[model samples]
Target: MSLSLVHSRALLGLEARPVCVEVHLANGLPSFTLVGLAETEVKEARERVRSAIQNTGLEFPANKRITVNLAPADLPKDSGRFDLPIALGILAASGQLDARKLAGYEFAGELSLGGDLRPVRGALAMSLALAHLANDGAMPRDKPGMPARQPKLVLPEGSAQEAALVPDAEIYRAHHLLDVVRQFLPGDTPPEVLDGWTRIAPIPRREQADYPDLADVKGQAAARRALEIAAAGGHSVLMMGAPGSGKSMLAQRFAGLLPAMTTEEALESAAVASLGGRFALENWAVRPTCAPHHTASAVALVGGGSPPRPGEISLAHRGVLFLDELPEFPRAALEALREPLESGTITISRAAQRAEFPARFQLVAAMNPCPCGYLGSSLRACRCSPDQVSRYQGKLSGPLLDRIDLHVEVGALAADELVNTPPGEASASIRGRVVQARERAIARQGSTNQALEGQAIDAQCQLDDAAAKFLNTAATRLGWSGRSIHRCLKVARTIADLAGAATVQVTHVAEAVQYRRALKAAH
Candidate 1:
């Protein structure tokens, strides 16, 4: 009997855990068996490996017992990512290929029956894991700290660029089973490095969607100001408006006004996309924007399954998660978001493994004031009664509303104003102010105002006596919780930044107070 081992990775949430693929060939009845807690897809790799070996003009060990095992038997393995490593292990065990050259490398890819390599999900995560493992001196080597022993990664040709995103790691691309074998086998000539596969292109910027600019929304300057504050602070916003009031349009433009993602933020966002198999490494850094329908289930919004995966919130990490008709969403889904909203991460636990995904995203939600969409409209009449309106609005629980920092009423636009107003300030102009505000916040607290807490807010958002007096009185009368109060201070800080003010002035406090007026009054 001969045994061979190769290293690979399995994704558990946004992270990749090391998996060892072990293959043994022994004298027994001709059969193949896959063990060690593999899912059905992984167990089915026997036929694929056999066919891939044959297509590569290699001899399949027929009329002999072939057993493949994925170690750490308790942790369930899913997907065909194990195919490449298993095939390589089988070849090594059969003495057809050498396994010594594979020690420092992590292998990942799906094998097609024709021996071609197919891309697997979570290549970025796998690269990140191997990079960390290399850095930690966990990889096997003669010299424990030798950098050459840094875990090299072999990925499907299509995923090589994505894997290359991890700095300081040598990435190899393989198009087929023969390509991988030739690199590790002594008598076989190594395949030439594939052309145009070494360098990964910079992430492409998303094309600007045709959204209504902030300049187009006329009147309700207060609402616009609230939107500006929300954009500047990265705060969750609730816009209660009547029908035809441009609430959706205003919310859509919010993305354009926000600052662009930093390289680190972009990488983190792209990492989440990689796990979901949505990442195109060539254009990997675009911020995610997810707008799930209100009818979305709790699982669809928060992420859950036998092997939990990311949901819309995780997909929208480091970007916008706009929930239009907010109250119309399933209550369970909305409630499930409360944890991530506060913690900036979501942990989904399955029977086998627990996975945590980043959920740091700016939430922009909109809803009508009432069921009739005209609860307080100036131009139209509301047909729903007070009781019915109350019930409709109550769809959004108070706890959920409490987590939102800014709430502004978007009243109906005057007909003449809608027709006559040219686009106001372009998105670029508004984005400049938002960026300035964000920079100021980052300089003071190392994060945006929305992420500030207790002492951090108190230290950075110190209010003048006049502003303090107004805020204290408003807090009492509005029944603001501690979180609401801190959020108000953060909003005030952002407003002050937007105005280029050095202190949290009374006017900034007053504007922040105005944003909470509708929510307080409704309560």
Candidate 2:
């Protein structure tokens, strides 16, 4: 019997666990078997691997007993990512390729019956995993930087480019199974330069990201200011308004007001996107805005599957998650968001496995005031009864509302007002002030104000005597929870930062209080 092994990765959420594809050939009755894969996947994988070798004019031990096993059987594997590894293992076991040459390389790519290579999902996650593993131990060198010890990652053309996004990663792109076979064929053969096989260069981060101009919205200064405060502090927002009040427009453009993404943030966001098969090279450093429809299920919002993939919230990490017509979303789906909002991470536990994904997204939710969509509108009279309005507004739970840092009312614009009003402030000017405020908060506590907790909250957001009295009195009368009090204090700290103030003042407290009152009737 002859045996060979090839290395690959299996994706579980953002994590990529190492997988070994073992192929063995023995003289016996003609048979082929695959183990460690779901029964549903075995047939397809076997056929693809077999046909790929035969079609590429490579030797296949069809007359002998062939066995293929993916080690670590408990790890759930999905997609065709292992096809290339399995095929290479078969060749090595059949004595068609040198197994020793496969060292220092990890492979992942789907294969066609014709031996053409297909792109695999989560390429960036795999690359990031390899990069992290290379730095797992040992101290840093004193004189020069530690030499990069990452394994060379081999993938299909499109996927290779995605994997190359990781800094200092060695990635090789192959267009066909033959291209890979040529490189690993018996000893000392020179690697020929072919158009089908090449190294992918990591694209540099974009200098600027494009978003819809905030200047289009006209004459809603209060709502605009609330958005500014939310952006400055990385706080969640709830916007209640009548239809066509620019709530949706404002929510869509909100991502532009926050600080630009750092290299680490961009890589993390891209990694999540890559897992979902939604990443694009053009969007390398651009902040994402994930706007799932109201009909989306809890699994779609927070992520759940047999192996547990990342959901919409995770896809929006380091960016915005805009939910328009918030009340229309299922109550269960809406409730699922409460935990990730506080923790900045969502863990999906399944019977088979558990996966956690980063969910540090700025939520921008908009909703109508009532069932008729204009409860307090001057433009049109609301036709829904008071009970109908109450129930509609009550769709949002109190706990969810309390977690939101700012609640602003966006009023409908009159025709004359729409025509007469000039363009509002540009996103660039607002983003500059937001960035300055964020820098101040980071300088003070090394994090965004919204992330403050326990002693950090009190230490970073210290309230003056008058400000403390005002907040205490308001909390008591409003019957707020400790969480609500803390959230308000964080907002107040952000307001103080925006004004370049050394301490929280009564004026900052008062502004924060007005935001919490926007949904008083609904509460």
Candidate 3:
């Protein structure tokens, strides 16, 4: 065969688009030609593939004219993930291996000069894309009358493990180029020993998620309660406090109180992490806590680039995004969080490509009460002027603040008070209550309270007469907007769930109202 075709995937944001590696060898002036809208990283794969084939003791078509085309030539291709497929296609076209055997299989891996197959990013995402397409019945058919063949993924060792995490995925792990070559040697005979080549099953980790303990934080019961309510309802929270009031500590331990991730949630979260090249087998099924620095830009939070990679918010999908020193972050960056906080997804549009990433992450943001971080503190006089305090609190827009379901104040503890304060309730105890409340909400409405909207919110968060009157009075007095009232209702609904109540009560409404003081001192 002088022409060979191989299947692979290209990542544009979270979606893994299909790409074809077509290799054609013809008699002409000896040369290597690569064509497609390929990026520099992909063009560099030519040398890597040639070196790998030669080092693996395979014949390289150096004397013959070789042309490799990554088709649909318009799709922009980056990364060395196409290296293995391009190498395989060249060999198959040059009559070194059976081209027919390459059907029904997808290959993606970076090759080292020593013929070793290195792991590539987005392996799990590619596997997930295959599953979605197959289950959605969109896979292309091999013959006119035949149904589409089940796709099998060929990846390097580390990447194979990640791909195997996808359920029922036919994943094969190849350690070296020679191992892959042995599989398609143009014969019906099987190799005596498939040493580096392996087929992995669904590798679901049974290990429990580990997080920073809530007991590490002391003397902030109100703040702790806010965290619990936020976790139970899947609501976003904003915590304002003086410096060293344990706001960051509480935020760090907040993930421990949320319910464990379901397999689907884990896969979505891990898939995004894998796209960011930050995934690990040990971190599987564990909720992520992404704490980007205050200096991070809007692009860093919302995700942007030529290929449009996922940012901190997407990486924190089904998990927590703790923004400490929230006011110190750029206003644009803070504003970028508003859409995802409501829609649970973020869409990034580049010049050539548009992609959306799941960003259903719990936001636990913390900020100082004032510029000096001690507004209304009993421990120290607030050094900043009233104007300074107003400007600092003004950093967060009303829309963004309204999107946050709970706002709580964490008071600074004096020296003697801190010394006398014992360890707070253990995270396991808080998590038990949180998980129960979450289950109750899910059982009642099929989703967390924060996800409820429109008629769903009114239906799920039904309030008693007294609670309704109280909430209305509070909102009227505070001049709350419609969004704020709805968020408060959701928070009250979560409080009711925690109390094992059938409906929101006056007490729940009152507690939820207290959490509405965005910056009580400034107000």
| lDDT, residue 112, candidate 1 | 96
In order, candidate lDDTs are: 0.82, 0.91, 0.91
Error of 2 at 364 (Å): 0.5
Runs of candidate 1 with Cα error greater than 4 angstroms are: 136-148, 188-220, 281-283, 520-523
Residue 37 alpha-carbon offset, candidate 1, angstroms: 1.1
Q: Lowest lDDT 10-mer window, candidate 3?
A: 141-150
**For model 2, what is the alpha-carbon lDDT of residue 455?**
97
Q: Which candidate would rank higher by TM-score, 1 or 3?
A: 3
Please give, for residues 1-523, the per-residue lDDT of candidate 1 as tens digits: 2899999988888778889998999998999999999988898898898999998899899877998889877777899999999999988888887777777677988999999999888888887777777677777776654553667788887777777766665787777888788777745575456552243442344544333467766776767778788889889888888878888788767777877766567778878888777887545555566889999999998888868889999989988899999989998999998999999999998766788999998898888888888876779888898788888888889889888989998888787877886666777788788889888888877988889876888898999999999999999988888878888888899999998888999999988888877744543
TM-score of 3: 0.97
Q: Which digits, one per residue and each the tens of the lDDT, describe model 3 over residues 1-523? A: 9999999999888878899999999999998899999999999998999999999899999989999999889888999999999999999999999998888799999999988999999999999999988777788877776755569999999999999998888999999999998988898887547879989988857756899999988888899999999989999988988889898889888888988889899999999999999999999999999999999999999999988899999999999999999989999999999899999999998779898999999999998888888888888988898888888888889999989988888888889888988999999999999999989989988999999999998998889899999999999999899999999999999999999999899999999999998575455
Per-model clash counts, in order, read 1, 0, 0
lDDT of model 3 at residue 199? 94
Stronger candidate by lDDT (1 vs 3): 3
Q: Which lDDT value does model 1 have at 439?
A: 89
